[model samples]
Target: MARRGQRQSGATRPAPQRRRPARDADGLLPVLARAVREVESAVERSDVRPSVRTKFQVVALLVREERSRVNADHTSSDAYRAEQLRRLDGIATILAKSAARETTLLGLLAEDAVISEAAASLKREMLIAAGQEPPREEPVSRPTTPADTTVRRVVPQTVVQRQLANPFLAPDFSSAPARPPRPGRLAGWELITPLLRSFEHAAASASKALPEPTTLRTAEGLELMPHQARLIASAAAGHRTFLLADEPGLGKTAQALLAARAVGAYPLLVVVPNVVKTNWAREAGLWTPKRNATVIHGDGETVDGFADIVIVNYEVLDRHVGWLGDLGFRGMVVDEAHFIKNKKSQRSRNVLQLSERIRTRAGRPLLMALTGTPLINDIEDFTAIWEFLGWIDETGPRAELMESLEETDLTPADPGFSAAARARVIDMGIVRRRKVDVAADIPARRIADLPVELDGAIGRSIRDAERELADRLVARYETALATRTSGSTVDGIDHDLVRRVAGWERSDRDSAKTGENVFSLVRRIGRAKAGLAADYAAQLAHSVGKVVFFARHIEVLDAAEELFTERGIRFSSIRGDQSRTTRQKNIDAFVNDPDVSIAVCSLLTAGVGLNLQVASNVVLAELSWTNAEQTQAIDRVHRIGQAEPVTAWRIIAAQTIDTKIADLIDAKAGLAATALDGSDDEVAASADFQLEALVALLTNALSE
Candidate 1:
């Protein structure tokens, strides 16, 4: 064999070939593959705090680099380029899967996601892991000359005075200890969802038992209810934080003002909805006569810096947030606290940030989030409320709550954790009481939906518009099916597909100017029913001492006011366009003036904060999109001071989307019941009335 081994060696030596190590058959770069694996592993582990943010940044950076390389490579054939792109897409798919595991991570994938310093650092670490040199950090250039900008807000003199009075305001940490770190059993696991789940499963029993009142202290002539007195007792016993979710008519206003009085939480800050700013001051006077309460108007020209109680509305909170933070308030009460449920809104941000500053400055400060209808859509609506109460922070439970969760010896994954978590949170100051529970303390309230038939051309036009809209939606759904690659046949109609089509139609309605949308159609129905609703309200005002007529549109209000004027019925107008003084004057005319038989109010402006309990009967001229709005309107008359049973008449247009919307509002009310009132009813996941109305219309059209 020609010296067997020697011959073979000579043949190989001809080229002096070098053997390369095995690589992925897919041809993924070694560095990129390593980075992908590392990131995937970190994101897959729930206990590792899931490096979701880092993973998103690394994958995003890789995608950008890979796209650039693919674009610049002209040597490669289109097929080869497509294959590279597909491979990169596979990496992106993994990153998406990782994000799907943590709901909070989804926001990072948004098109406008900002690359923070931490994200940039993580990108470099990922690049280094991929055996590639990270890009050099570019030096941030300083401007040669500072740009001049006008100052938007000047520090108020009251703020300066307050600061001068308490120059050494320091954060009190005595209530929250830093030592002996207490990591809970659920410390590593996300517990917010489970904590909320507990509320969902809570029984619809009456209010939970409260501590016995040690001493019943009533404000001069103000007689406290048994439940109200009990809360005052708890405050006197040193309970600092409370989420007073008692139903609307249970005297939350009185309770909040008096509770502050009991704890000596003077120089208290009460943040309320604009509609209730005046009401808060009035209630403060009634409940705590000794404490001087001042309401802050625009620019706060009339605000008393040294008043015992300072009341400000949410609308002007932004302008006042800076000074309010430096005002050294010992207690804070946020009325209609559900306004801050959207944690991302500027209003919510200002409220939560100001609350945080107050908590930091006065560790033992009394914080209360008072909302009769707290659970608007979801149980997690409690997030901002809990934050306002200082029981939890942005990261997770605060030290005291963490300690409580730790003592439970269970994680969210455990079976018994939910109840334990609920008990723990409830013990930390969640007070939920329904009108049914305290029925004796307050009058019963009923919502009566009055369906009216629309006749003639306008009515027919409305019906035709609704049918046309539904037909359009159905056409879209069919088109989507025809284009689907899979020839899959669905039974009846694919509800999910139907919902998707409805959602598209609904969104299109917002921007589309040529077509009649659900919103416009509802408005049309309101217009058609305006005369009838006004006639009924005029009749009600005569039968029932006073009637509060509420409507969503100014046109409807104008029509009702015109009818009232023609009928010789004295009426007062409360609309958003009116100045605060005008609004107050109109409100007073209805409340204190016997000649003012009706208060024609904007459902949005006069709904939440005004105490129209003076009128036991309310006429809702048009339906609202949400049950909360409707409840707020009805509650304006069904509050604590009302001596008679309250009835709300909701005018619904028959044989139209208005009836369906009225039903949807009633259905949506179940969300609050299941969440706050502890009803076991199954809550519809989506409380979006407009979407539901579109779905109903499409379903009906498709069926026909």
Candidate 2:
């Protein structure tokens, strides 16, 4: 970064390069040549930071614009035109070398590489530095297109900067209008309903044949499972629309992110459930580290509009849908696509509208409908998901689907049309892979951490409370040290003193019920996390079936149950508060009922005497005081009778005491057991956890 500044400011630059500069009529060419040379030097040194990358992009853009002007200048002689073109070609060659040296820079030259404001300003500065007037901004002549008039639309400041930098969106000359299909035998046949019926009648496995992957590793060194790589490989082969119905534990988030990168889908829009929105951004950072991703919370006050990826939850789609349509996303991914099965729902409408806008603008944008399971009884929802994929519209099949149906040479009147039609739709990119299908690639039992950011007022209050608690602990430690009776001094923090102080605080809170203690604080965090955890579990239920949801507190369990009921997902609850017979009955219902998607279990009670191998996925909604309790709950599903690999999704609130406790559990209790069944830690009560957490918190405070 410092080198980039030096290169731009010229404070440390050699004077010889500028003193004997070659002359050009307008001087723009020399400026571009000099910048490109600097970029080349940066590339050679492997120091292509954001500023250098922006400089490289601005240089390319200027060279292209200048070349176009030079070609169109009727006043300039052929000799002059030839000379300018040759010089532009020379700069272009350097750009190619710079790109070759730093292959990641090549992505910036792609069509969808967004021109950041910095790059735009750099372009103008270069022109002015070369003794040419900067281009004037044309007034936007378009009239106001009022949309969501009642809804307050938030345009983040960064987004405004980007908009102001590039007022005119790059035109889509790549998409030529599609020729209307030749009228075939299936012409007037009300084909969409039959297409819906075909899926029902031909209820075979809907997984599509995928291309073999050329590489299984991402640029960030994350290796893809074989099944996941197959889908990414298919996307690279130019298959845009996909209904990725991979089961819950199959790393769908990673696959979706990598697939987006495969096609260079920048300014990508991801519509996910509220619970998993933060997880989506985290996965984006892991799989596509070079790209910037932002999550839209509330009215999107904190959103980074300049980010390459925009993640939003379905609940707030109504508020931001208006501007999201105009955000110039080249791709759309609907996670848990079954959420939009009802086209009448506002979420469905917003997603479809956004998909339509992306398709209309991007010509052929990448559209993926991700679900674990299709609504078996509701073909209407499948139609809605297909609509979101742009495979069909209101009246009938879209151009792509219609063309595929035409090639099959069969109508609904034909004998084998159902099977053929379903096959064609599957080929249009329906990829379904279950855990058993890729069991060898993953551990038989695993815990996948789903870090959820608690946003809005509730999130802010919790953080405030945590800080207050920390401050109180810090004051206690300082007071104790200032008036030490033993006269013992330590250079660094006194770990013993911190623990004794934490114990005193915990005992006071338990006795007087005064300030927030670690126990009560944890419960508050649990309540805050309940909705997110439940929402994630709902997604799992929709995608796959038979998930176990375990929460430490009844309030967390109750909150989760309320959410599941609101979402119309069938669930059975097994709690310590329930009668023995009632608990058994609920457990039996969960084990036996196909409609029961989730079994909400108590971490303590359900830890013993249960064989719930029916579920391969577990949702640990709240943290347990002991590792044994949490391990026991997950073991119900990850036990001996389980046929497929199991995944326990641990939901932790990011940037809070919740994260600290989770880390402590993994480190102090035991890290991920991997092939081992359980942790080596003893099963102590919640008091031990409370003491340790407070100790860790106070120690951190004193260190700061």
- TM-score list, all predictions: 0.47, 0.74
Any runs in candidate 1 off by more than 4 Å, and if so which? 1-151, 169-181, 205-208, 215-219, 374-377, 443-704
Tens-digit per-residue lDDT, 515-581, candidate 1: 7888888888889889879967875664445889999998899989877875679999988889989
* Candidates' C-alpha lDDT: 0.73, 0.80
RMSD to true structure for each model, in Å: 23.5, 21.9
* Number of colliding residue pairs in each model: 1, 2
Candidate 1 yields a Cα-based lDDT of: 0.73
Question: Which residue pairs in model 1 clash with each other?
Answer: 204-678
Number of the top-ranking candidate, with lDDT as the measure: 2
- Per-residue lDDT of candidate 2, residues 1-704 (tens digit): 34333444542246445432233466898889889999998876756666787788889988998999999999989999999999999999889767644544655675435565556556656765776655564122232223311223466777778788778977454877555666787788898877878777555678899988988898877888888899999888988889898888788888888888999888899998777888898889888989999998766778987899999887667668877888788899998888776565446777889988888888778898888885345676688888888788788887878989998888899999989998898888888877887889888988889999887677888888888889888888889889999988888988888888988887784532546667777888899999889978887786677899998888899988877765578999998889989988998999999999999998978888899999899999998877777778888987887899989999999988988888777764443453255655444433377788888899888877
Q: Which ten residues in a row have the lowest lDDT in candidate 1?
A: 143-152
**Which whole-number lDDT from 0 to 100 does residue 627 have in model 2?**
73
